[model samples]
Target: TWSTDGVINEYCEPCEAIVEGELVEVPPLEEREEFSLDGVTYEAFNTSGGLGTLAETLKGKVRTLNYRTIRYPGHAAIMKALLNDLGLRHRRDVLKDIFESALPATLQ
Candidate 1:
């Protein structure tokens, strides 16, 4: 039962090593602009908060790095539409409230 399979061992290494290793700062998200048929302009930005931070920390240590958000498939579309409708594109507090109201809290 003590077979040291390299594949399994490498895959099962301590998550703490990646989670607690290095701390890095995340740069601003990359953005681009697009216009709808009605001439409504909108800005699209990447979801890079913790992901960017982790990528910076693991830049050289890991071969590849990426970040993913856990949300409903249409979350972005819903958010964009809400922001456009409310004219609160850059309002962080309002955005936070809108999102928080929609998503349940994992921890108190």
Candidate 2:
């Protein structure tokens, strides 16, 4: 679900196990890659999203799978700075305020 404050809260059925982690610097190859889909160019980078859960469920079933998040160029770096360098991850309220104020919602 999404909040008016520009925060997206997600919920899912409890997994048998949950993966906990911290953000880490992505390798160059995984940091930025360009791809074309449906005549539109996009940038992608490795992110610690739901891959851990998927990996746990697919253990031994698939040889390998790579997961990435598509985002605007430089978006990862900015997020890293906000959530890691600036230590906003520990203060979600501040982060939400920043998002709500600095970034106006857009249909596009």
Candidate 3:
């Protein structure tokens, strides 16, 4: 969705480097966020936010099913970039700060 919408430009520099294969070392950062867990690092590129197109394709085909952990637009890419740039696996608060400062709030 984001790619089609040209949202990649909104992604942070670190994420762009990772996607371009310019980042090699990933380490821990001084600040961390709640979602981040110690002893673990994350790297991602265009990870699905949820079932995505599958949800529409499977509409009405099944029942009693649920899915979670759909990453917000550009969130995963930025996160991976942050992890690699900051040398930390998880920096939940820092990530939050970065996004909050960079992105405008949306009512939707």
Candidate 4:
């Protein structure tokens, strides 16, 4: 799901059927919240990361299955600005170029 080239696909092709069957959808960006772990607080928000497939496979076996992507504070805001405010969502090639150019690969 992640790549050193900065082009990560968030959706799993194998999960598409499960997602459609379950009507799974990502929550609104405004619903994002912060959580603390090891004294560090990070922002998390629901995304189409293929949780529905796992949920469907484990139906009745587990009480719940939820998935979210975690990122540094304000990361979501920047994404919202780029994808919504600047209308980059419809222009993914530009967005991908921006990401590849601005975000350097890190070992950490």
lDDT tens digits by residue: candidate 2, 16-53: 22223322223321446888889878787554433566
Q: Pick the candidate with the highest TM-score.
A: 4
Tens digit of per-residue lDDT, candidate 1, span 5-28: 321222122222132344332222
* Prediction 4 global C-alpha lDDT: 0.59
Give candidate 4's TM-score. 0.68
Residue runs of model 3 more than 4 Å from their true location after superposition: 1-45, 52-79
- Provide TM-scores for the models: 0.38, 0.55, 0.30, 0.68
Write candidate 4's Cα lDDT for 1-108 as tens digits: 456222234421112222334533444344588999999999976555446467668655655455667888997788778777988767777877887788776665
Instruction: State model 3's lDDT.
Output: 0.37
Mark the regions of model 2 whose C-alpha exceeds 4 Å error after superposition. 1-31, 37-41, 48-53, 106-108
- TM-score of model 1 relative to the true fold? 0.38
| Model 3: lDDT of residue 4 | 20
Segments in model 4 whose C-alpha atoms lie over 4 Å from true places: 4-23, 27-30, 59-63, 106-108
**Model 2 misses residue 84 by how many Å?**
1.8
Model 1: how large is the Cα RMSD against the reference? 15.1
Root-mean-square deviation of candidate 4:
4.7
